[model samples]
Target chain A: MTRPGGRSARVRDAVHEAVVELLAAGEIDAAIPKIAERAGVNPTSIYRRWGSRDHLLLDAAVTRLRAKSPIPDTGSLRDDLLGWAEGVERSMRDRRGQILLRALVATMAPDEEPVEYLRARGDDLQNALDRAAARGEPVPTVDEVLDFVLAPLYLRVLFRRPVEPGTAARLVGRLLTALPADPAPRAGRGG
Target chain B: MTRPGGRSARVRDAVHEAVVELLAAGEIDAAIPKIAERAGVNPTSIYRRWGSRDHLLLDAAVTRLRAKSPIPDTGSLRDDLLGWAEGVERSMRDRRGQILLRALVATMAPDEEPVEYLRARGDDLQNALDRAAARGEPVPTVDEVLDFVLAPLYLRVLFRRPVEPGTAARLVGRLLTALPADPAPRAGRGG
Candidate 1:
């Protein structure tokens, strides 16, 4: 693991924190110099790290969101999916997370920011999927999860639907029933 | 049947057509006067009919999109679903439909506009769902169709995914399997 006390790691945490704070304060177009000043890091370091202000904003939002909700490693695929769904529900409910979700929604149109932000978010979902597959568990494909789980979460986000407690469970249940790991019967299995 | 050639009906048609044209031409903020001019109608009549500019825009977009797609009544739940899915795919593929979809997505925030715009669109889905039930066929709940079929279709709209012919069939297949009209067997049935 990267050294937690390292200056570089501390700087990254500070910069990301500043980005979220500024975004919450409605500084969606906050300049890099402002972010650097808020984070107490050199502008040069931020530019070298993220290449551009937009990149840094997207990175901060996604990185922090992912960090807060690491993909679950529950032994059961059902539990794993439920955990993943709850984490997404929690993320969108957060004030900062709402800002991030809006940011992602804004990029739904063509020629906005590059889609790498969404693609990078896909990696988190993939990590959960790969974990299920590695344990010889049936796993839904990435697209299925997106369609069944993520789509509903985001649709709720789109509609400003209040997140109910059982929302994630219901979504995961539907996904499990629809796209079972290996839907076919196993010939070698005996009762 | 309603009179299609009535003066009021003609006015409504012209105004809706004008709204869609203006939206596609990148005049998202086109005022009522502009819309009236484009439709070759009086501004007073536009306000008299729609009451407000925002109302007119929402009414026009939803009306035109719904008009272009009358809900399918193919006499079978499966085919009806397939037809409904294909209609959604076709709508989002259309240039004007894309504009209206973007308009809807932009309202994903807390206070962008009324949720009635989306609710009106939801009526289209309900029409198909209602049709299935009226025929004594098993049917998925509104949420099931939203999560399974409509979610993926709209997700493609969000992600700019290409429209594949099998996309609707695939989505409908999963929905049918996941949420059958009656998953349990009848008490008694003779062949």
Candidate 2:
């Protein structure tokens, strides 16, 4: 509580907590002044650190959401994907997370321009796919993973559509079915 | 140039044009009074007809966007989906449409509560699926269509990721592969 670095970190944590609490309460249009007040941090200090409300809110939201979405390691691609999907579904049920996702979606630019917020999300999915490949399982390309698995989940979340319990399983089943068949090596020389 | 019972309709059209023009110019936070001034419609009239800025923006955006996304009637499902995807890609390239989508995303309540703007979009996709079924083409379920076809398309539009030229074709190819093989009827009954 006393060290300089530790105090700064604590201030950051308090700010994140304050923003999340406000956003969860449905204050989608809450201002930086209110957030600073709630956090007990000086307004000038917040502005100096985050530069803008967008940057501050995005950081707080991403930090909280990323913590809840740790990749699972179940030793198989199917189980791993299903677990990850379920975890995401559970996480999506949080109103605060939905608010964050909506903000990220609204703020992102068109394709061909990089947005760190969205890219970080893709990285989580990519990490799961990489683990599957390391286990000798046939893996789809990252684009395929995004298209087949993650995109629908996001759509359902963003649209406020009910994601049935079996939705993720069904998606994984479809993705696996569409995967390229593993090529067999030559049994003998080119007789 | 409008007929009888058309004065209000003309006013609506003018308002829509003004809103679209302002939004396309990146005035995302533009207010209704400004919009009313631009459209030559009284502020009271705009407020009476559209209730809120969200409603007016959504109405204007939807009216403009729906006209640009006509369903394709190509001979085959492959051709049809590819054509539809291309049409959507073209439509998304419009800065105005992107702004509208972003606003819609930010404003939609969670999935348990249906929003008319989002539902209208699903109707368009469902129409295409219904057409394919009428043609005896193998059609994926609405959920599958949302996941495989629409999700990736939305992701590309929302995020700044590069969408390859053949992205839609590739998605369709994978989707077709995942579809259940057509079940053949038994030639011989219980003889």
**Candidate 1 accuracy as lDDT:** 0.71
Which lDDT tens digits does candidate 1 get at residues B1-191? 14478898899989988988887887877899999999999999999988987778767766766665555778887887787777877886776786776666653444453254556656666777677677777777666677777777766666555556677778888888775556343322110
Backbone clashes in model 1, listed as residue pairs: A138-A181, B138-B181
Candidate 2 per-residue lDDT over residues A36-144, each given as its tens digit: 9999989998999999887887788777766666557788877877777666666676666777777666545333245556556667767777777777788766666
List model 1 lDDT by residue over A1-191, tens digit each.
23478788899999999988887887867899999999998999999999988677767766776665566777777887788788888886666776776665554554343254446557767777677677777777677777888887777666555556677778888777765456343322110
lDDT of 2 by residue, B1-191 (tens): 12446789889988988887777676767899999999998999999999998788778766666666655777677676777666666666666666666666665643336554555656666677677767777766656656777688777667655556666666677676776667222221110
- Evaluate chain B of model 2: give its TM-score: 0.78
List ranges where model 1 is wrong by over 4 Å: A1-61, A111-117, A180-191, B1-11, B27-37, B40-56, B112-116, B180-191
Candidates' DockQ values? Answer: 0.28, 0.39
Off by over 4 Å in 2: A1-8, A108-113, A183-191, B1-8, B109-112, B183-191
